[model samples]
Target: MNYPKFRKSAELFGVICGGLLISMPAIPQAVAQESTPKINPCPRIFYEEPHNNQVVVPQGCPPNALTQRLAAQGLLPVPATPSQEQTNLGVGGETPQPSVKLPRPASGDQTQQPSPGAVSSDQPPLLQPRQTPSATIALANGTVNIKLVNDTATNVTFQVIGDTAPRSLAGKSDVTLQGLKAPVTVTFEREDGGQLIVTPQASSEPGNLNVTFNEATNAAQGRSAMRVEPNGSVFLN
Candidate 1:
């Protein structure tokens, strides 16, 4: 070959190699920029305490809705001390909340429970007081004639128990029970809501008794007037 032609071709090859070497660094730099990931900035942040002189930083951010709701409810996390600055803080999912404690009752504030068999003061008594007879007339040993007069508005029932059968005397009527035994037990009950006020008048003729059932009096004066003596004699009113 010719020397001048050889020298010109060699210079052209060097220019091409120099241009390729310069463009090689730019191509790799463009490829590296396209492959690299973009970093997103966190809107919220949380700090982690240092342990063993090492602290870990987290890339994730805390939730906005949960933090705001807790703040409205007065349940936020405590902050660090003002003297110390927090560094390399981490963003965690959970937030530290304050613990709630209820107040305990004092010893004097405790309630006293009533006993099982205790009775209330406002309740009425279970048994009523026994009544006393207005008057009593003792019968003689022989047989007697007795008369019962009902002066009430309703019908009255009188029984000369075991001496004779029971009899029902109408309202404003009279009944005569004759030849009854001396120790007779007589019971009277009204048909409606009224008690019999018996008043007795003993005859001086030896063996006659007049018993009258008047209108209903008060309950304190005794509903009836009769008693049985220990000597087998019956006193009636």
Candidate 2:
């Protein structure tokens, strides 16, 4: 072949081979599939010490899966002394709020300008007047104060006021909740292989609930537990 024609043919072959290589299917990259979490079995509470008990499961189990959620609902392992304690949670004596006493309407005279935002009714208040603010009562700023202390050896995860993600609390630590607009359920769950739990002690009132996370071996089965519900009731499980 002529020199020019031969060179042109070689260039064409090179271009065609390059195009074919470019159009070929690529080798599949390894697709990174998310692994499924292993299923965990029901948790068990066992005696860790002569005087204490703990709830735990084996390794490779999903952390905080089965038992922690149950504890938050009052369905499992509630404290034994929720109601019997000397302190009354939501109950109290009547103490009238400071107010400007208006002149009494003359007997049988029902017609009067109603106070702004006042509902005139004979029905009594569902909550009787609280005596001077005790510990559990709402504060002057209207935030209910709650204190949680972790007294166990292992770390724990907790949720408050309907939050789904659990926050970690180190052992021998304390946390207080303030400035919450609504009542909340506080749940504390032991991490996998953990044994201890949190318990709510009696408070002076309902707005400020105090709790302690103590050793599982030292706790009363079905008695020592997570904090009381936001509604001011204790659950025994």
Candidate 3:
């Protein structure tokens, strides 16, 4: 009986070893390696054609062989030529016309004369040159006294009559004849009516500045002289 028990135990141990062997899994196989993606070497090219059979390469095309060939062969469009009728020829071919001027009117050509007793241009009544009167200028202290002989009028303008005198006299309503330093012929003119004026030459001192008055043109209405005292008093002789 004991020998059979020993045989049973050996069978049990063999069954358990078989079960362990079945539970263990087999080793996995190695995965296959992947290759890298390769990039395309050439870029795309686009062409535009506004006219038939005329291709235009836009700016973006690269300077590769294909683009250079297209540009050299003139596959690109060409600008149109202008018609001959639209051209500008200068004015060199035209002729100019002549302009005409009209004649002017004629003026009077005959000479006319005035009758007797009327003023005549030929042999006009010899208007004796106007007779100028005698005038005198007296310089005493700081005052100047102007006197006229046979002067019927009141308003008169007297001026120094020499180039050496100041171009114009100073400090007088009318022109001052006393400022003439050299021997000057002073002239007295009447503004309204005829009057006599006596003008004297330059004097050394104020004692007596005497000037003779005579008709400027006639010289014969006799002569008159005026004496000027140092006290601004004027005496006619």
Candidate 4:
């Protein structure tokens, strides 16, 4: 516990350290080397899209400490989607094909097909072209005779292309429309009240078209619609 005892202890400690230094195994220079970052992960896999620009995280690997530290520095996901309207038109991609207007509910504006062997316009789906019924007819011939007979007891007014004027037939009355052309479409609308079954027999040569009105159709109720095809085939909806 005295100064001499401490001095002796220090001398003995220095001697023991010197001996250990001479006998101990040498530490190679490898301890000073640093390891590269595991950014690529082991087995190195990557995904180009959807996963963004970052490499895939290897399974069983420790959490990415550097990535967690700089998570905000990665690319923002907001810019990936297109924003400009023109780009959305798919400028570099195939232009989106236009979708035809399928028959909507209660859209009565439907045209009928022309006569047999008649070149009809582009028709609706499952039908020929939209008939060019919206035309003005010339009464060059003496008269196109169309016998209009109303089976139901309801007055109905009828009109179509190539018609000089709209004609009205009384309820349950049979009338012949004279001085008309062939391939004339007759559209009927109920005048008095209730449903009217107006049938037109083209009692003359050539073919005539009859357009069916699809108005006030209620799906909940048992109401139906009529579709005229390019072949003049009528379909009840």
Of the candidates shown, which would achieve the greatest TM-score relative to the real structure?
Answer: 1
> Relative to the true structure, how large is the alpha-carbon lDDT of every model?
0.61, 0.52, 0.39, 0.44
In candidate 1, what residue range of length 10 has the lowest lDDT sum? 79-88
**Candidate 4 pairs with clashing backbones:** 121-129, 122-129, 122-130, 123-128, 123-129, 123-130, 143-179, 144-180
Reference-based TM-score of each model: 0.38, 0.33, 0.20, 0.27
- Going through the candidates in the order shown, the clash numbers are 0, 11, 7, 8
Candidate 2, residues 1-237, lDDT tens digits: the string is 499999999999999999888766442322223344322232222222321223433332222434345556776663333232212221121233457898887878868677888876865868876433212333324445667787777777777746446788888898887645434555666774445544555557546657777666533442323333344444423
Write the candidate numbers in order of decreasing TM-score.
Answer: 1, 2, 4, 3
Candidate 1's displacement at residue 55, Å, is 99
RMSD of each: 24.7, 36.8, 37.0, 22.9
* Candidate 1 C-alpha lDDT tens digits along 5-60: 99999999999999999999999899999998543332123233232123222223
Candidate number achieving the greatest lDDT relative to the actual structure: 1
Superposition error at 49 for model 2 (Å): 90
Model 3: per-residue lDDT, tens digit, 43-119? Answer: 22222223212433334322334455665788643323322321221112122344576555445644544666787
